[model samples]
Target: MIDFTKRQKEIMTILSKHEPITAEQIAEMLGVSKGTLRSDLAVLVMTGQIEAKPKVGYYLSKNMQKQKQQDIWNQTFVKDIQGVAITVKGTTTVNDAVISLFLEDVGTLIVVNEHNELEGIVSRKDLLKVTLGNAQATSMPVQLVMTKQPKIYTIEAEKTVFEAAQMMVYYEVDSLPVVKPVENSQALKVIGRITKTNIVKALIEMGSEA
Candidate 1:
């Protein structure tokens, strides 16, 4: 789960044999500088793997079971990686999409219909290809340039972040629209997004929690 470094694992091993250990003792045993230990210890403490008592010492938390840590790492819910999804209506002009792209500072825009149901996706490259030199390109509807349904890739909130990442790599895209499938309808409602950057943010948060 929290892919600990070899030195960090050794630090844990040392703590396992001793109920509580001093920071100095850990650094000496691991042959690492206090500065290095500080970072490792911070991650350990942040992840709840170890507890530090001021003026006392560091001790492994009783609740830090291996299985518990594994369970936390196994979480795949897309909501765990959810972030704001920038969108534009299919009827919006390419010019407007460009403006939104610049205004929002996002690489792609989710295109939706009147009901806010997913219709397609537009990327910077998509806009560039059609609008780069054409004077009338700006007036064209975004839907005309978007990668529409049956071609665009999407992820569900219930899916795992790993799967989301996999889809991005497979599709050679930087992001995926997070959607909710209607029980009886053919449409999906766009809710959020999970991007490569979102994955990095999630990992950072996980490290912080760790």
Candidate 2:
């Protein structure tokens, strides 16, 4: 399914009951300005879920098959929309970590070894807790405050987006490191990072294709 947003579904329902309704009337019923819904209407029209005419107004499209639009949200892999991971070495100082945080504009940084294997994860909040009251801690290694291996949560590169989303909700995390198994060793390589923002972007992109 296209995973229609609540507003989009409501608009469809209104069209089903009152075919050929104008955008203004739909916006008025929903208590929002027509401009606010322009994008939503455009998406519906582009996806073939709804149709519009110059003099007539809007109506539900009967040609579209809801099921065949299928379940991209559930079947897509983490690698499909994953972004490059912002990385830092475990030996990196807390001061430098802060600099990387701002420079990278990422909430989490994957800690890696010289071989580029996953070692730990340090977040913006972790940096704050370590440097909040004690200025001396800025000189300390980030490993001291990072969530190290065996404790850090990660998602496999091939895992489904559905699984990634479920893990994020259950763990209450904003992002996860995307890892791939290393040959002849148990260590995992940090290939990418997946965040809530990435998931949202994926949904929006896929929704448009529907």
Candidate 3:
């Protein structure tokens, strides 16, 4: 099951009690910047925990009630977070990574070595900086262009989805790599990736239609 952070829980509680509220109101109540509140709101909305109305503010979606009944959050696990996981060899060129990103329609790519062990992670932002002025993408190795030893987040297959959600909220990350324990950090194996998009989809599937 996914986990919810204290802040996320508090925010959800606030929305539960006073939804259809403005981002300004949330910011004031939470003593956070509007930008931070907006980020939280984006995650919430993406997870189907809240809904936004143009010029009307945000509200707790009707799905909340159904979520309670089905225990939707409790049913989520690492396996539920599966998606297309494209891997690139560390020796691959930066240009190849860019092409993969476009072709795969993915923002991030997991870089692996010859042994299929994760070496690093590359995101659009990482590539943009180098591509901004450079003409050669093929010359740059992915290892030199990727975010090495990134802060890794994981959840066990048997854990509750709420726990996973909480971790994401606490870390302010869009996704978490579900992994199986290995002898060392370099040995970890990615089983799946839990993302905000998947969480929202799960909520919609379990929540009320309206």
Candidate 4:
């Protein structure tokens, strides 16, 4: 089962009762800063639990509300959304990894060891700092520059898509590594990835049907 923090639950309750409300209103009611409210709102939005309107404010979308209810009732993980993950070896050169990111049109890549265990993650932003400084990508190894042992987030293959969506939102990341249970120490293998683009595509498809 997916777990939410007390603060997140409180935020959800507030939005449910008085949605289409501004971040300011939420902050004032919760006795918190606008920044904190915004962060909480971002998590809800990313999880598809709530939506923000430009001038109108924030509201719990109909789909999300229904989904939440369904989750509480049946508590099933819907596997409708899916995507493939691209990975690179930790020993790969920075230049090669950069090329892979471009070719895949993805913002992140999971770095693995020879045993197919997740070693680290490299993101476009991580490479950007070095790339902009005129450093030779060829000379730099991905291991030297990549984010080591990043907080790896994952969802069960059978879990609801929203679970993965929520994790991405909570962590403020673009993608999540899909994994399967493995042995000790390296207990998960990178199997796939989920991104904001994938979530948007699913939403668009749902909208098109309506």
TM-score of each: 0.67, 0.68, 0.61, 0.60
Model 4 lDDT, residue 100, Cα: 97
Candidate 2 worst ten-residue window by lDDT: 62-71
RMSD of 2: 10.8
Error of 2 at 135 (Å): 0.6
lDDT of 1: 0.86
lDDT per residue as tens, model 3, 1-210: 556667677787787667678888888999988888767778788888888898988887788755654465776665765564577988888888889999987778888667666667788888888888788765798888887754555566666678877888998877766666667554766656667887888777655432
Candidate 2: clashing residue pairs, number: 1
lDDT of 2 by residue, 38-65 (tens): 9999999999999999879998786643
Local distance difference test, each candidate: 0.86, 0.89, 0.74, 0.75
Ranking by TM-score: 2, 1, 3, 4
**Highest lDDT model number:** 2
Q: Write the per-residue lDDT of candidate 1 for residues 1-210, one digit (tens) a residue.
A: 789999888888787666478999898888878888998899999998899998889987877545434445468578987898898898899999999999999999999888789999999999999987798999999999999997879999888877887788888988999999877998999999888998877767765555
For model 3, the stretches where C-alpha displacement exceeds 4 angstroms are 1-70, 183-186, 208-210
Task: State residue 93's C-alpha deviation in candidate 1, in Å.
Answer: 0.5
Clashing pairs in 1: 46-210, 47-210, 76-160
Decide which is better by TM-score, 1 or 3. 1
Can you tell me which runs of candidate 4 are displaced by over 4 Å? 1-79, 207-210
Clashes of 4: 2
In candidate 1, which residue ranges exceed 4 Å CA deviation?
1-73
Tens-place lDDT digits, model 4, residues 5-75: 78878877787667768888888888989998667778778887788889999888789678655554244
